[model samples]
Structure formats: C-alpha cells, structure tokens
Target: MVELVFITPFVTGLLAFVLPSALSRQLLVLTGAVHLVLSLLLWKNTPQAWFAEYFAVTPEGLLSLLVISLLFFLISIYTTGYLAAHGLKSENIFTGFMLLFLSTMTMVTLSDHIMVLWIAIEATTLASAPLIYTHRSGASLEATWKYVLICSVGIAMALVGSLFLTFSMELGGVTSAMSFSALTPVAAQLDPAWLKAGFIFIVVGYGTKMGLAPMHTWLPDAHSEAPSPASALLSGVLLNCAYLGIFKTNKIMVSAGLSDFSGTILIVFGLLSIVAAATYILKQTEYKRMLAYSSIENMGIIALGTGIGGLGVYGAVICMIHHSLIKSSLFLSSGNILMGYKDRLIANTGQMAKQMPKTFVAFFAGFAGISGFPPFGIFIGELFIIMAAFKTGHYLAAGIFIFSLCVIFAGFARQVMAICFDTPAETGTGPAADGKDVSFKEPPGMIWPQYVLLLTSLILCFFIPDALYQTIVDAVHAIGGGLQ
Candidate 1:
C-alpha cells in the first residue's frame, strides 16, 4: 500500500507519455484521485512499509503526504480546465511530468533512508523542470535552467551531508543501516562535531531547495514562469518535501543533544529568510513574483517555529499545513487573473471585482488568509509561534518576527486592494479582460478549486479534528516539541 502511493503515479506518468493529449489530461485527474484515496487509507490504517528500512509512515511524513495528496487532487482538477482554456502546445509532456512530479514527492514523504531521501528530492527537481519551461519562451527557458542548476548544486551539498552523517555513525562504532529510525536510538553515541557539521550542511542544502533566504534566488523565477498549476504544487507541497529532509536531520540533532547548536542556526536562517522576503515583496511588481516571495516568507516562519521547539514546533506544523492550502489557492487564482488579463503585472490588473467577480472572491479571500487575517489558520499558527517565542524568552526574535509580519501584510494588502477594487483604464483591451461577455464566465473547474482550498483553510482554523490534532502533536513530539 505504501509503495502504491507512488507507484500508481509513476505508472500513470509513463502511460501519459504515449497516450493522446486529451486522454492523458484525463489520466492526470484520475491518477490524483487514486493517489489521494491510497494516502487516506494509509492515514486510517497506518500500514507498515514493505521496505521497512528504506521507507516508513512517520507522523511528519504522513502529514506531508496528506497535504500532497489533497493539494494535487485539487490542482489536477484545475489543470484539466486550464489546459482546455489556454491550450498548451505540449499538453502530454505537461501531464506526464506533473504525474512524475507527484511520484517523486510521494517518494520523498515515505523515504526513511538518508541517501534515498536525497535521491527523491533531487528527482523532484528534474521532474518539474520541464513544467517551468512549458511556455517554450526564452524567459521560461532561463527559469528552468536556473531551477535545475541551483537545485542540483544544493542537492549535491545534501549528498555530502549524508556522507558526513555516515562518517559520524562509523566514528561512533554504530554498525546499523544509515536510516533515520536506526540513527535516533544511537544518536548519543554519534560524534557531536560530525553530527553538527552534517546538520548545517543538510539544512543549507535542503534550505536552498525549500526556498529559504539567500539561497532562494532561483525560486521567484521558477514560480513566476511555471504554469499556475505547476506553480501551485511547487509552492504548496514541493517546499515541504525539501523541509522533510532538514526535519529528519534535525531529529537526529535533537537526539544527539546538539539541540542548542542546531536550533540557533535554524533560527538565524529562518529570520533572514523572512526579512529578505519582506524587503522584496514590498517592491514586487509582478503578481506571481509577489506570491513567490510570500512563499519564502511562510517557509521562513515554519523554520523559525521549528527552531523554537516546544509549542513553536506545533505552530510550525500548523503553519506548514495551512500555508499549503492558502498559497496554492492564491496561485490558482492568479492563474485566473493571468488568463483574464493576459498580464502578470499588478498595475495592469485592476477592478477585478467588477470584471471577474468569482475570481475576485477567491483571490481576495486567499490574500486575507495568506496575510494572516483572523478566521484563517495562518493567523492561529502565527499567534501560537509568537506566544511560544515570548514564552521561551526570545523577546528580540519575537519583536523582529512581529515587525516582519506587519511589513509583509502591509505590502500584500496594498497589492490585493489594487487587484480587487482599483479601476483599470480600458480593461477590455487586454486579451481576455472582457469578462462581461456571456462566454467569459470563469470555468467551474478553475474557480471551484480556489474556493474549496480557501474554505478548507478557513474551516480548519475554527475546527481541527481529533485525529489530525493528535497527528500534529505526534509529529511535533518526534522533534522534541511539547507544551513547555
């Protein structure tokens, strides 16, 4: 069953390469539904992995798997409509790679071995590169090149870190397999210096893939250039896959009693990412690029929360889940905006409420949710992270965190207002801006996914199920998190 989670997508992806474009597009949605069902079964039954040493259903991995399954399912629905309306030149390739991308991400979630995790994360970069180049334009080509080059370098660093971990095990006289499960119990015996060095390299390596600051140069280009459904997956779930590597490595650091050293580095990287994102987001001109920067900011917040540990870890998990839901919806809504206006510039996209009312609803609601407004899960998650920071006496960090959040919200809010309410001059001049035409109604598939995504984020803010709450708590507990 665990293998089926990824195998189903891989098999479908291969078939999509030969299938007719129309048929392959249908396969995209079908594969997503099947994958989602398998993930749900895994969650309910907690099945044992066939290859126990190489793969296992840990709490954090399961949470990530759930998000990937749900988000992919929704995004697939949107893709079918998007391809139909926009008419991609290479629809089959896009469909095939999207499934392959899903397979790689699923592999990341279930991987238990250190090197296997590295392989899976690197595979994701390869599988999604073509999706970024779907437009076949020079700009998209540049984005794809930067994405593959930068991520390859980062993954190579991660491989070096994995080797360092192996050396740590050898130094400690531990003969067990280099799997996360095997390492945790004997972590105390591992050399502290090697483990700390491994942790730093792993974080820096995977942090680059996760779109953490300074290393996130490739992200804005890739996200802005990729087709919106691909962008949604990249922002929503791909970053989490990279974070999973750092997260498992962090667990080893905790078990080895190097929490202080490892935690401080994470805090510094997290804070720097947020500040960097805030600075760029304020001056962002392209709407998609603005959303990309927002992803960096949210990833930073998640890292910061994880570093703080205790309740902050719990908050980090919550933020990760909700950010996936809301940010993906915003990207899909941006797709609608792009389709309508035929432009990515914020200044050119105004009076959205008057032109495309349904999209405006999803876009504005998503903006509010991402900006950490009340009645959204991000607001709750950020609240808990701040409370935990203050509780742990990180007063200066807390102050900086709040100030960054305020700055981000102010920038995001200004853009949202311009998109929703400000009137545009000669709106119908753009390719598809004449939304008043009877033929111009936003497609049901494109419009509904964003609605459903936003609503799920809103609902979760008020009511979390017992099982999910327990799963989140268990995930945090694995990383040395508690109420404190």
Candidate 2:
C-alpha cells in the first residue's frame, strides 16, 4: 500500500502518454485523487514499507507527502482549465509528465535509504525538466536547459556527499544500514570529522535544489517559464522534497551532538539567501520572477528557523506549510493574469479588480497572506520564528531577518499594487495575440483552486487537528525542537 502511492501514478503516467489528450487530462486528475487517498490511508495506518530497507514512513516525510498530495490534486484541477484555454498541441505529453513528476516526488517523501533518497530526488529533476519546456518557446527552452543542467550538477554533488556519509560509517567501524532511520540512533558513533564533511556537501548539494542562495540562480527562470500549474508544484512541494534530505541529515547531526556546527552553516546560508532575494526583488520587473524570488526568500526563512531550533524549528515547519499553500495560490493567480493580459510584465497589467474580479480577490488576498499579514498562517509562522530567534539570543540574526522581510514586503507590495489597482494604458484594452480581448473570461475551475488553498491555510492558522499537530511536533522533536 505504501509503494502503491507512487507506483499508481507512475503506471498511470506511462499510460497517459498513449491515451487521448482529453483522457490524459482526466487521468492526471484521477491519479492525483488516488494518490491523495493512498497518502491518507498511509497516514491513518502508518504502515511499514514492503521494502523496509529503502523506504519507511517518518513524521517529516508524511507531512511533505500530505502537502504534495493535496497540492497536486488542486493543481491538476487548475491545469484542466489552463489546458482548455491554451489548447496546446502536446497536451497529452504535458499531463503525462505531470503524473510522472508526482510519482517521483512521492518517492522522495517515502525514501529512507540515503542512496534511494538521492535517486528519488534526481528522478524529480528528470521528470520535471520536461514540464518547464512545455511551451517550447525559446525562453522556455533556455529555462528548461538551465534547470536541468544546474540541478543535475547539484544532484551529482549530493551523490558524492552520500558516499562520504557511508565512508563516515566505515571510519567509525560502524556496520549499521545506510538509511537515515537506522543511522540516526547510532549517529554519535560516527566519526565527527567525516560526518561534518558529509553534512556540508549534502547541504550544499540538496540546498542547491531546494533554492537556497547562490545555487538558486536556476529557480527564477524555471519558475517564471514553466506553465503555471507546473510552477505551483515546483514552488509548493518540490522544494520541500529537497529540504527533506537536508532535514534528515540535520537529524543525524543533532543526534551526534553536532547541532551547533550544522546549525551555524544553515543560518549563514539562510541569511545569505534572504539578503540575495531582497536585492533582486526590489528591482524585478516581471511579476512571475518576483514571485520566484519570494520563494527563495521563504526557503531561507525555513532554513533559518530550522537552524535556530526550539521554537524556531516549530516556526520553520509552520512557515513551510503556509509557504506551500500561499505561494502555490499566488502562482496560479499569476497564470490567470498571464492569460488575460498576454504579458508577464507588471507594468503592462493593471486594474485586475475591474478586469478580472474573481482573480483580484484571490490575487490580492494571496499578496496579503504571503506578505505575512494577520489571519494568514505565514504571519503566525514568521512571528513565532522571530520570537524564537530573540529567545535564543540571536539578536543580530533576528534583526537581519526582520529587515529583509520588510524590504521584501515593500517590493512585493509595489508590484502587486501595480497589478491589482493601478490603471493600465488605454492600449491595454486592445486584442491579445490570441485574438481575445484583454478581459479573458475567468474560469471558475482556475479561480476556485487558489481560493481553496488560501482557505486551508487560513483555517490552519486558527485550528490545527490533533493528528496534524502531533505529526509536526514529532518531526521537530527529532531535531531538539519543541514549543516548550
């Protein structure tokens, strides 16, 4: 049953390749639903994997799985409406790859063995690279190639780090299984020097894919060029999959009593990412690229929170959850803007409240939510993180965190306001390249998914179920993190 969660999608995706385009779109949605059901069942039962050595259920893994399952289902719904509007010739191929992408990400969540986890993460790159190229435009092609090249290089470094981890085991004369679950209990016995080396390489490698600073160059282009649904998944769940690797390794570091060393590196990298994002976001002209930078900034926040531990770790997890929800909704909303305006520039698009009223509600609300306004989960998450930072005596880091956030918020608001309220030039009323007027009819299918995601985040801010809360607690507990 655990394996079935990913296998079902993989098999269905293969079948989608040969099926009719319309049927393939249906298959994409059906696969998402089935995957979600299987994920829920696994959550309820917490079953052991058939291949216990390579895969197992963990608290963090399950959390990521649930988010991926939910987002994929909703994104698939949005994709249906998007496909209908664009009428791509390779719609079948697009749907097929989307399922494959889901399958690989599910595999990432379930993987336990270090090598198997590496394989799964690498497979995600393969599955998703094609999705970035779905449009086949020159810019899309460049973005796809850049994504594949950079991520593949990063994965290769991660493979070397995996080998280093095993070597660490050998140096300590440890004979444990090369799986995170198995190694964690005996992590203290591993050689400190080799362990630290492995952790550094692993962080750099996986961090690259997770959209951490410097290595995040591939992200803005990829996110901006991919189809909106694909962008949602990339920003929403895929980064989490990469973070899972770093999180697991950090667990081993905590178990080995090397938390300070590991945490410091994470903190430095996290701050660097946030600062880099702030510099670019203020100057960004393309709205999608701006959102891409926002994703980078949020990833940094998650990294920083994890490094802080205690309340900070808890806050990081909350940010992770809400970031996925809000960012995915924002990306979907960006798609609606793109469809109506036939442009990606913020300067050319305006008066969304008048032109696309339904999307305006979602877009503006998402803007507020992502900016960390109250009633939104992100606000709660960031607040907890800042409090934790101060409690831990990291005043300088906290100050930097707050300052970067404010800068980012100002930049984000300027762009969002231009899009949502500012009136466009009279030429904006002209026909688009598709021969449709600037007022493209808004589809409920596209509009509702964003709303559902935002609503879920809003509800979660106020009330979290016992099961979900416990799962989050368990994940943080492994890293010496707890609200208490």
Model 1, span 286-385: residue lDDT tens = 8999999999999999999999888899889889999999999999999999988888988677788878899989998898888888989898888988
Structure candidate 1, residue pairs in collision: none
What are the lDDT figures for the candidates, one per model? Answer: 0.92, 0.93
Count of clashing residue pairs in every prediction? 0, 0
TM-score of 2: 0.98
